[model samples]
Structure formats: structure tokens, C-alpha cells
Target: MGFLEVEDLKVHFPIKGGIFNRTVDYIKAVDGVTFSVEQGKTYGLVGESGSGKTTTGRAVIGLNDITSGKVLFEGTDITSKKSKTKNVRKDIQMIFQDPYSSLNPRKRVIDIVAEPLRNYENLSKIEERKRIQELMEMVGLSPESILKYPHEFSGGQRQRIGVARAIALKPKLIIADEPVSALDVSVQAQVLNFMQDIQKELNLTYLFISHDLGIVKHMCDDIAIMYKGRYVEQGTKEDIFNNPQHIYTKRLIAAIPDINPRNRADQFKFRQEVQKEYEHSYDDYFDSEGLAYGLQPISDTHLVALPGKG
Candidate 1:
């Protein structure tokens, strides 16, 4: 019933070995992940490296092929039917991790931003030119910069070009794959604020995948903690922050250091208190098939993964 839903999705890559190269085994990059994104909201995916958060986001956007399961947009499965990919892709756009490499230096900014226009629309010469100028202005770039190449701008400016391109189509769901991870600390907040403004103005949905729990807590209304291609826990922002039920989730929070020793000590004490709470609720989790599915109700907005068996 959500605007976008991913059900039991899996992506596997073959691990080839030996001379003949028979299918030795498969690396489960993403395994049986299920979640939904509602319009005008953000759902964040946070985890360590190799946890398949990127893979899952890629699968939903058709960047990576779906080995199994369904990715539904507006109640229809786009993964099930290849012909629908082009149409489905328009509604969902991705802002890739790197800004420098993502944009082409050879092409001018106008052409780069207009690539999506060419893909989904058959605009006339005058129409394409007009649209590209508007896009440049939308993401805080001057229309004069339209003629400039990627090399003409700094890192933050280049990222603004990427943002312009992503929003050109006015997509409903924007999957930001660590969009700010590459920028300087000062620039990161500016870009983040821009994204927030766009999300509010357009009522756009976002699947923000990042390793930084601090940013996750700042932007996400809800959080899903993934481990080894498994969703170890998921809940609202307040729930995960105030009452984390998973050990991995607690560890991530504790590791976010405050420069002051006193603040750090307080965080350590808080971790100890939460650990005791998790221990008390460990027995309530149950197994589903080969995977353990833990769902503990906390508040109307918060839910925790079943503790233990991680």
C-alpha cells in the first residue's frame, strides 16, 4: 500500500573458481530485504560495509539486476517486468556517492543536467535549452555556469550539479547513496540543508543510505540497521536513539565520540543502561525459517529487532 515497496529482494553474484569456472558459490550481496517508502518521508538504511545497503538500493533503481524478489512502485512490480523499467526509473532517481567522477569533464554543465531530459522527454531544441537553464538555477548554480565544464567548479559546486540532474525530473523517490560522504565537513552541512529544503518543497521521499549514524539521526524519520545482509533492527529516530534494542545498534551509538571526556562518560553510562534493557527483552525474539525475524513493539513509531542470534 506504500508508494514504493521492496519485498523479499535478493541479489547474488557468482564466485567463479577452478579452470572450467563452474558456479562454485554465490555471494549474497542482498538477501530477502523488505521495506517500504511512503511519499513525503525519508527511510534511512544504516550499516557497516558489505552489509548490502547499497546493493539493495541499486536493485530497487534497476542499477543492479534483481536475482529474486519484487520491487513494487505504486503497487506494480517493476522487477517482474523489464519493459516497465524505463517508466519506473523516471519516478526514482539516484544521487551517486561520488561527485567528481559522476560528472563528465568533457561535457558542459548544461548537457550533463539535460541528459535526463533527453532520456524521458522529446523536447525541441529551444525547449531543451530552456529546461537546462532552469535546472541550473534550481540547484543554486547560475545559468551562466551552464556552459562551464565539471573541472571549472569545486567539489561542492560539482555536487550541486549532480543534485540539479537528480531533481530535473522531479522524482518522488530519491535514493541518496552517501551523497555527502565525500565532501568536507563544512560543505556537508550546506548540501544536507539544500537536500532538506528540496524534500520539503517537493514533498519527495528519500532512501538515505549512509554509515554515519549521526547524519542518519538528523535526517531520517525512521532507521533500519543492517548487518551481513540482514536487517538486525529497525525503528523510529527517537526509538533507535533513546531505546536501541540491538547490540550492534548500541555499539554504533557509543562509538560516536564527544570530544569532551565528561560527555563521553555519560554516553558510556547510557550504553550500559540500554544493554541491561536489551538483555531483559532477549527471550521475546523468534526464528522465521533459516533467518531470525525479531520485531518488538516499543511505541507507536518505534520497533526493535529481536535480541540475540545476531
Candidate 2:
């Protein structure tokens, strides 16, 4: 079994309306998603906003309730609330998007990072201070600055503090939802590289969720392209980038900005061709409801949502 497994996970929110606020319909945020993350590897869930990438990560981390499906961590069924043991909670953690709002404005950096340690460990004041300092140093921040508030730091620095809090419990898996999307482009690389460094140092497994395919290509070992709450394609990084099968995947990849001036013309032409193909063959790729069909394996490591069966 993989280190982290989510099988057919679905998260639906009740859409209440009318006089009594009864459930008239359900908004299917995450519809039948399944994947696994191996130990010390990053699994990328890529999509635009409202495509359920964040919802999937939230469900796996227990922020959102699952409508159906199973979540197993290291072969333990932690799907239900009762089944999620204290050890299981300590094993999994999340680094949220928007560091500005994620860290409490009222709390000092020391308290922010020490919250998890306090919950999961019985350390004295000196021990907690030492551990928080070590984590601050690990994320390239000053141990002395632990007394300051979140507003005292830049955007990237706040994110580093968020990272420190995430690793405080020594989690085996981290669900990072758009970890660097809120930061400046120049600082994004620094945070990502530092994350990789710590991943190697700590042997961490990551469920990396984001809309940027460029970042996904840089960070992930396996990639799944999500659209309208379902997966359009999933494969190894090479397969998804070099051999994208789904039209939606093709469009997303083609939409990535090409920075090379020499290749701009060629890139534009390729994007135009992909767009043309997508417009003309849209019906061939999706169902009547405009959702991707269930995943079908094209190879041992590649799966795509296609129209027909073999």
C-alpha cells in the first residue's frame, strides 16, 4: 500500500433553499477522486479555482467531511471521525494557502509554531522554546524573532512560519493547498526550494495542490489533472507533461506562459492548435454533463478519461 491513499473520495455540500432551509440539492465539490502518495514523494493535484483540488486536500486532512469513500494512511482506515486516532492526527498536517489569514494575527510566532507541539507533545516551556527555535532555523528564520507577530514578516516569511508550524509535529504527510500562490513570483522559488530541502531532510510526503502547472512540473513526481470535480488525466510527471492525452490537460499545459523569447512564436502556434482541437473535439472528451469520464488506463503508469472502453 502507498503511504497515503484516498479511494473514490467525494465531498458534497448541501445547498439549502426556501423557507425552512431544507437541502434542495448538493454541490459536488469532490466527485469520486482516487490517488496515492508514496513515501517522501509529492503528488500534485492540478486544476483551476473551484475544480475541487483544494476540497480534495481538505477532505483528506479532515477539514471537509466526505460524502463517500475511504481514506487510508499507512493501511489504517482513518475515513471516519471516530477512526482518526491521535497518532493519525499527528501523522498528517496541512499547510494552507494565504499565509496572511492562516496564521492568527493575535498570536506571536512562538505561540503559533508551538501550538502543535503543545497539543501533541508534553514539553516544558524551555523545551518548547528550543523546539520552536530549531523549526524557525530550519525554515530560514531567526530564532530570536519568535517573539514577534505574523505582521512583522514579509509574505514569504509568513509562509515559512506556516511551514514551521506544519512540521512541528513531525508529520509523515502534508497537504499543501496552494502553498506559494499568494506570494510574489520572485519569492515563490525560494519557498519552493526550501520546501524541497526540508522534504529531503525530513523524508516528508506531500499532497501538493495547486492551479499552476509550472510549479507542479517542478515539484511533483506524479500529477493528476482535475476539472469540474473529476480527474481528466493522471500519470508520472513525464507522461503528463510529454504525453498528455486529455484535451483539457492539453489546454492547461498549452496555457502555461512561455518565457523564452526565441520560442514565443512556436509556443503561440502550439497553443492555438491545442485550443482549436479542444473546441472542435470537446464532446469526444467529456460526457453529456460536461464532466470527464472515469479514468481508463492507457499504460501501467498513465490514466486518462476517455469516451469509449477497450
The local distance difference test score of each candidate is 0.84, 0.94
Local accuracy of candidate 2 as per-residue lDDT tens digits, 178-203: 99999999889999999999999999
Report residue 36 deviation for candidate 1 (angstroms): 1.0
lDDT for each residue of candidate 1 in 1-310, tens digit (9 for 90 to 100): 9898888889998999989998899988887788877888889999989889999899888888889999998887789546756787898899988999999889998889999988999999889888888887777888888999999998888888998999888898999999999999888988899899999988899999999998998999889888767777778888788887666687678778676886877888887776675466545442443333545556776656564445
Each candidate structure's TM-score, on Cα atoms with residue i matched to residue i, is 0.89, 0.98
Candidate 1, residue 244: how far the Cα is off, in Å: 0.3
Runs in model 1 lying further than 4 Å from the true structure: 259-261, 265-301, 307-310
Residue-level lDDT for 112 in candidate 2: 97
